[model samples]
Target: MLNKDTLLRIGCFLREQTGKVAVYGLKLNAQAVYWHFPKSIACFLDRDINSGFFCGLPIRRIEDLPRNNIHAIVIAASLSAESHIYARICDFCDSHGIVIYSLYSGKLKAECLGKAFPAEENQESELRKAIASHDIVSFDIFDTLLMRKVLFPTDVFDIVEKRLREHGIDIPGFKNYRIQAERGDKRHKGLAGIYLTLAEMLGWTDSQAALVMREELAAERQVLVPRPGMGEILSYAHDIGKYVLLVSDMYLQPEFLQEVLAENQLTAYDELYVSDDRGTGKGEQLFELVRKEHPAETYLHIGDNAIMDGWSARVHGFDSWLVPSALQILKTTEAANILSFAENFNDRLLIGLFANRTFGNPFAVREKLVSVKSLPQFASFFLAPLAAQYVLWLLQRAKIHHFEGVLFAARDGWLFNRLYQAAAEIMKLPNVPPGMYFYGSRKLCISAALQEEKALEWLKGHLVGQTHHFLRECFGFLPGDGHIPPAWGEDTDLIWNEVVDKKESIFARSAVIKDGYERYVARLGLKREGRYAFADLCSQGTTQCALTHSVLPNLYGLFFARYMSGSSVTMGRVETFLPQADWHMLANNALEFIFSSPEPSAASVDENGNIIFEEEDRSDKELKLLDEAQEAIEKFCHEFFSLCESDGFISPAIGHFLLSMYQQPIFAGAGKVFDGMDINDNLMGVRVDCLLTNEK
Candidate 1:
């Protein structure tokens, strides 16, 4: 419950202290330790042999712990587990009369150490006073006023490589060429000049280089966006009657910059300056020019780089604030370990930077600690962004593809449709296009399409040496209607009638199935010749194909994931992290667990298409957990819609990243998300055989 001010005070206290400071948790993989401590750290306090502290730095054990001269010891373990560990450390520190800094107990985000940037959330009064004291303020354009949606500045070269491939020139090492070959020298000029040098160096044709340059330029337009609260800063300066100038040491030209600014509607600056036009950098020459032009005024520069903004401005007699880069902030946190997979610091920086640009670091908890305890709040924090993306994509896809409507196929699609409706309301699109939760499952669709000879053949095709019991269930036989003995291997090749030996019974059953299916469609009140898309979580095109081939011919599939008939040829390139059918049934698990399914899988319908209830009261434990999860999910959708109504839309890149975290291993990871969650059958409480491994 400690506020950032308290944490900042502790950080300042630690920073002011002099001497050989030691970090207690760095050797124990305590992340974000450096972010809250001084640069004078001299040793680590861990005795574990397996700890990654092999830098030849001074290391300590509990028995040999220094009681003197070691300025301060900072606790960097997680907030949840650190208190217990700190109690022992605290007693030792108190006895030794040594200063102790508990980073886990205080807010690390509030500390302005390392690459941690203080956003407009803090230091507002100081910024305002500094602006008021000065007649002019210069802001670094990139990473200050505008943020690029990438980790490293060089990562943009990946887009250029993509462009090269599209133009029939696939360079294997183009990213490296852009990162390594095209910088820190006068060899290349202009924005595409580097690509030109890269192309020539790699013996690529001028056409290929031109294509790369074209793509790089286009990528800039797509990538650059206003950082959160940037416009407010600009407006605050303008309102105070302070002259604002945009400055950068970038290769992109002023004209292109102006175009990009205008494209984003960020033309509030009094002037713009770039190193490309000046042929010199932002150290002194740029300031000299600005000072001469705007005489008799104090200049206050706010830029991301300490050297480029701070040292340069102070040396030139102008006031400056070293606004850390958002990318750098991400880099620090990624180092601190919010991103579990970020092993290398540089790689963490890249991902952190990308995530910042994409979703403004969705997991950036200012005060709240991230743990299973905060999972109930995940709706607004994690899932709302993802849900918003799906809603927008559905809308755009429906419009562009000229589909009449999308039927959110039952089970997962049912929950998706409800959320979509909430999103539509939030977006103020009351006249939402044709979209509805079409109550249809694979079982329902297949059964409705049965009675035809083709369906009979399709059913036969599905039973490839499988049990006759499976075949019976596949045809929606009511438990023990037909006597089909189980078989294995080549024995399954027996004739269908011979296996069942109930032709009269099957004909009567076929009539009931056909009638039920016809009634189901009739009850839906649909018109003919409607181009409908079957929407599902991870469709195998079973429901889509069955409905299209047997019932309706104008059905297309819009699914999160799609499996082929036998091969891995997807219906389209599905952008998802769905566990494969050969490994785990992700869609099946989602249908039963993630989505708000109040009942079991759809059983056979009555002749009138009324859903026949296979009544089984759910266990109190499963119902409580499922309802809690579903309620949280629904609340998250509500919050997402509210944000949309207020013109706040989540990005798809961020959404995709969060969804990736829900992969099978991650979802069921012990002590992580969904640690105790189980995969269960809604009807019979039967654990899906494979998932039973994680049940305990």
Candidate 2:
């Protein structure tokens, strides 16, 4: 409310002024003056050459104003943002001897009426003083008290569009209509304003418009969340016994705004001031209503926008402050500083956008740390979000494609599977193709690969890369220490018989692996024809292929990523999901190394499902290192699963940085989390050749 102090300032300003002044900015503030104090604003000024007139006045550029008639230009706009022209207007005003006064030039509490300028950032404590002076503290609401989770303000519409799609409402190119609707809504002051436009353009009925509006509300309900500093400020206002009102220059009416407020647990305000409700917005005559509603009371306005929240509030004779977002700060400061070190344009964009969207606790950037580190802090920064996205994608695909529950493949799939289960439970997505684990691994599947004489021939041709440790560990052959294995011949059955006969092996690790596989099927209870998906870290499609040649022919493989073999079919399942070539971000080196188990994949599983290990004869140091890495991975995974919720998502931009973490040790430079962390190269390579690479 423009009370005694504010009115006294107006009286003092009038006494100082000799000639007429034009309010430069036809936004709600100018309209407010036009409605409340018409004689004060001689004319309206338009910085942009836009022809859209406001308040029945012919808008003029600073150049168009007559030098003799208009002696001053009251800048009822923002200098903090690019929306208004400050320098050009100042130059013209100065050159013409037309005195210019910026409304944002302030430190108003007791409200000393001044034309002198002041700075922006160092006013938070002073902002509290301004609030102290006010009987009622009226906030701008959107960026002031409440904040949306998305990047931009209008990203709210994108969520609405998604809701429309979900409801089977196909409105092609809805963005154009939305933009137009916004114009119409502001013009007519609500959703009812856009009804005619909708009917004229898309032949939408009043009922259809209502449905779209409801969907928009639903979208708001979906995305809306409280800002970070919400509690402290609101608590301060309440404790001070100040009448807090959420005054917004918004299209949504008080009733609708109430619904949103209640949903977000923000029902503390004394009243809601919406522009559309009165057909007048902030910077317009809307403050006149505020003045009328709460006579003799003072106000302090707070918001993110400089024009409406800061300048307009000051012009209307109230204290105001700008609350710059972290996004704005990053775009202004950190982006350029990172340019020298950034890998490329997209890399910079990823970093910038990630910093823009990702909001949480700051990185526990360790200082004066120990000499050695176990692993990188890529878990919180990269891997967690990546896994979350993967899980989200999996859920999305399962629902869209109508598949049975996913079966997580054992070994590398361990972490991913666990992540999926945890996220699913947290998000209440139990019905999203209910999942389970499948004890599938390269070691376990290699037995199925020995089906025919031709398969053994294929194996023989690809044995060059196999180590003595690999053979002894994976195949239950070559128990004695040897660099090279005994050369094999055409008889596949005879070769296996010699290998199996070397040790006191269970018959399950038999001559040809036929009886052993039969036992595996019975023990694991793997039905011959379940239409379930096999989840794993990566594959050459061989595990599924092996299963295809044996039992469970109807099963499919779901790998985190996969390389193509001659046949893309796994069991009878097609190659449905594969990362794009550009997604070869790590070049398959680091990620392959990281998503490993402490122990090599079990070369064999028995009738009772007990895992058979190959590293029994291995040294302790290698085992210890593997254990450390695995523990680190599990700890990272648990923390990730804990932090993720339904409200947040893993964007492709976040994924880009995540891939960068693997592509190169990008975050390693931070040195706090990963200064001396080492990759266990020993475990990076599986003992046996899973792919049996085509050694040319």
Candidate 3:
């Protein structure tokens, strides 16, 4: 909405002006008359009797108007009737001794009148002001602003004749082809069409003719230059706070044109409007941009072609000045007429032209801040961190260690229990203590016996047994599975026989194991006498419980891994998932590290009070170890980051990894004892390993 001050200024100008003004015919023309004139001095006159609704003022016959006291009359007709009314008014004014003044005349007394009319209003007053204010005004770059120059207009005819003479076809009226080609070339529609006509005249094939035309046109385009005064005009526009807008019909690359503009030093336009970059023709796009960026300012559009720029402006409601070269005036008159006609017509013509045209909606203007609708629509950015935190909370409540949903596991207890028992027996040997054993289960513990020198040998033996058990129970295989029988041989069968069948002797030998087994069975409510009791307890406690717990620890591990990954993916996700938490942690950690350091000595201070900080140096050994540890941490973190970045089974993978990290024997050594440890000795090996491996 325009301010009342603008309206009042416009109204004052209308009251003060005394002239026969020719207003292009339009719906708003009559209203503009009211905007410009006092009610007492204004009169509405039109030849069409039915225009009363639009005129607002009472219709008066033009012929019946008294000649006295009417020194000047403004032609407030529709654009379609502008020329017709202008001619009529000019003749009438000349005969009646009245002076005829164009609406665009600079002699108009009111400078503030132009200020009142907004450029976006697309009124004649605004166009005049823009033209008067700016020295250079640019139009469409392609057809309107430039044309292909012909090297030899008459040569087109000569070539056709030469080709015909070679063919020896002395057909009557053969010279007519040359005449037509020359005429077409003069219009500068490009030589391709003319060449096609020449091909027809010479009776050549389409391909042969097209090849010749393409070659010629390509050569011609290399020497292309700006139209006369175009560069100077652009500089002038920039000097006077105007701009050179290259609103083209064809899609032109911005980079190429930008280079051109830069080379010419004509890039200082307050703004540039390019159709290819901005999306479409200058009609609605120009008006929409003007409304957003240059509201209330004046603008002038100068162009050679009329259809692309001239009519586009008139129909779409932007003020346009058509400056067709003197030679092009006859060809552009029809376009000028169309523009004039569109001013009086309703929005129907504009709508029809824009229909099926792929362009951004003119009404969808850019706003400074988010809209109320967007506040809810884009709430995901704000709520994602909260959602992740809630997920973490749920995971903690569940007390789940690992989640292995993506990997396949047998549902039966008997099969899984056999596997667990086999792994446990292998781990319980002299060298492989219960603490050293690690199976893919929570409750079962494996051990082995070997000298310190045979640690690797003992590990190989344990791996063989574990692999055999996995094949038989988890995969439901028999002894003939090649690697299984050979690796297990007789030792595994003997251990299985003694441990599983002779349970009483086994329990007497290891009371801790017996107690753990009993407690596990009790927890699962398995009947002691039943054959399936042990299997049920093992499957329920190790497989089911371990699988459930996998979720929590795995998720935690993934979070930590991503934090250490150093990849942008983790950082980005963390930004979304825990924006405030991440920022707070980073800020706090950096502050603590910075402030905790010793302050620089006074001797190191510069005259400006700036501290000349000394760089901390580290030994090669320390640096090497730090680099290695950082690399390992980075690698470990990358795996988690990769999982989070993917959409496939991400939650399950994260849960499992976290669970494994927390529950693994490697971490257990740090005094963070978990469930299922019977005595303090069970944790000795883990603690020793952590102490040896600790880098800090």
Candidate 4:
């Protein structure tokens, strides 16, 4: 898989270069270079950096590299994604006067290699023509009428192995044995024979094999969903009064397949033909049995397989229509290489979930559209996993650190808190820190910490524009007449100096803000001496710094990510879920959008312990999208945590992969949900565009 010969050539080329060398991608192809020629490479570069090091070499972002530090950059991505990655970074490398090289031969592989099925439109068109001309229309069951969520049919064995391990049936290499048994035994004996062979191979008792068999069936039932596009064609055939049949060259029991079909509501078929039942596979004699049963009828056979459903059916004198399987169709898109990189259970689960959600129709990614039709569905498949993993990591860390409580800081924290609560309950985590929504923000925290010198410095740093915008937005107070400068450029320094000039007024306001927060915390049942953790989407620890200076000295900061290394006060007191490498993938504002609440931002607190809020700058439509997206995320978390037996650890590499795929402009329909949305820094009076905006 590494193409060792190509790697050796690249290694020799790298050794011949004079200056520093860096590999441009963090996949296996790139790691191969570091492993073989450790002395030749200086560093690694990747847009989606999940770790600080790969094979003992430091990883650096292209933009972070100093001038003349590296003489050449070598690309190590797969050929499918290699071109796009090359184009993306080539200009930057050229501008920096760095040469570009590739570990690959720079040749593009044929797009649809091997015995891939026909294109979706062509297959559908041919099926319609055949249905009109033929009296009987037979369809292949799996991958044609119904689709499974996993990447491959064999992946079910992996799931079964995991489930068995969960139930204390730790059979090492169970998946390998399961595959060997299915392929080693007679094909016509069905599921029982496969299990029988597995028992003999593994020395499993008959009852033990039966229990595993039940689990395999359950996994199949759980992963299967109807292929909607093909289902439409099946319905049309039945509506036109043509005789229909469901055919499959599968070792599964016909009764089980029938039950699954009924569960999927595929009732248009007149008969079913199974290879196991007839003691012959489709490419051999199963089609002949079907022909004998329904003699002298013009037949059209539609399936995802080119051989079993096409050539074999034509040999039996029936017309054939070939539609590519979801995996085959996936090969035509950029995700083909990424999906191929999944080698472990968790990695495969993430890939399977993505493929199941996007490639079920096989034609879904053909147009490369980034417009999302269903916000809820997009949230479930795209946004939810990453968000859930962040909170799950927070919960696990909280338990490990033995924190007394967690304060989910207001606004975006509202969603994070909800997800945390839902996941903790589902996981049944014991002694999980009590999490509550704390009405705190940068403005409120800065106001509470005005007396602190560091807090004053942070406030001054934010004064790049009009002072009135700062005063009204940050403190909910208007500036006086002299504070409004005659010219636009003159006010920032003038107003900031004026604010420092009024120390007595600042003291009074700081007292009021601190008192308001103290009362609010009391009402939430959090004590001043309690070790409460503040959860935020991301920050440079300004909130935590301010809190430690003015109040809540026992508080800790738990962030999803930090844009940069934090201030000195938060050195040991703060934690982040994302590694330093992933800090660049999602902006802090984008994180706020996904982890958002419908309520307006908390501007400051009233004297009576109520939360004073900024104006609802978001339109009603934006609010609805936020509500739907968050709800979808919550639902996804509940379902995912309920079924998955994770230790609250999702590999950052897999997280990086999902995030990287989602960020691509061509990835299916992801841009639609975040389109036209704005991420508002209510305290700073700055509005940044959503990450996925401007794609259209």
TM-score of every candidate relative to the true structure: 0.48, 0.62, 0.22, 0.75
Report per-prediction Cα RMSD to one decimal: 15.7, 9.7, 30.8, 17.4
User: For residues 1-696, what per-residue lDDT tens digits would candidate 1 score against the true structure?
Assistant: 333554565567666777756766653333344444435566677535423353445566654546546746766554444535555665666667566655433322112211212444335556677778877888888877777655556656665665565568778877776766556446566666666667667787887667667788887786677776666777889877888888788888899999998887788888888886875566436766777778854677887776666544544556677655665554444222345543332233334333453234222323322233333433333444445456666765565567767788766675678776776766565445577877666666666665555556665565355435444654434334444444434344455655355444555675686577667766776544677766677656666765765455677666654454562342323323233354344324533455646665565678887865445445676566656656676664554343231222323445445544333232223224344555543322234531244431
Question: lDDT scores for all predictions?
Answer: 0.57, 0.54, 0.33, 0.71
Q: Which one wins on lDDT? A: 4
> Best by TM-score, which number?
4
TM-score of 2: 0.62
lDDT of 2: 0.54
TM-score of 1: 0.48
What's the distance in Å from true for residue 58, model 3? 22
* lDDT (tens digit, per residue) of candidate 4 on 286-373: 7778878888557788887765676556656677777767676666666777765666655555566666566667445545543457
Determine the C-alpha RMSD for candidate 4 after optimal superposition of all C-alphas: 17.4
* Cα lDDT tens digits for candidate 2, 1-696: 233443444445545678777777777655655666566667778757545567876677666776538877665554453224444565566667776655443212213321112334324455566667777777777755665544455555655555576579878667567877676533354766765566667888888888887776665565455555553566577678888877788766689788877877777778888887876666555655776788754666666666677665665565665665535443343233443444432233334333433321111112211122333333334444455556656766666656666767655666666667766775555567777666556546656556445554444333333423334545546433333443322233434545444433422343345446656665655566656666666565656666666556666665666655444432345443435332233324334444554555555655554656554433466446445554554544443333233333334445534445332222333323332223322221333321112210
Can you write out model 3's per-residue Cα lDDT over 1-696, one digit (the tens) per residue? 223443454455455555433222334655665565535343555555624533455454444344434454554443345435545555555555543332222111212211222324433343445656743344555423343222222322333333334347453454466466645442233344566567766786888666555443333243233444444555556666654455554333465555555654446455556654565445334535544555544445566445445544433334466544322431222222222222211111121111101011111111211121221111111111122222232222222332221111221122222222333243231221111111222212221111122322322343444433432432233443344343333345533432233334323332333344344434444333321111111111223222222221221111211122222332111211222222222222211111111221111222232323333333344334333433332332222221121111223222222222222232233222211211111111111111112211
By lDDT rank, best first, the candidates go 4, 1, 2, 3
Clashing pairs in 4: 370-669
* Cα displacement (Å) at residue 642, model 2: 19
If ranked by TM-score, best first, what sequence of candidates would result?
Answer: 4, 2, 1, 3
Pitting candidate 2 against candidate 3, the one with the higher TM-score is 2
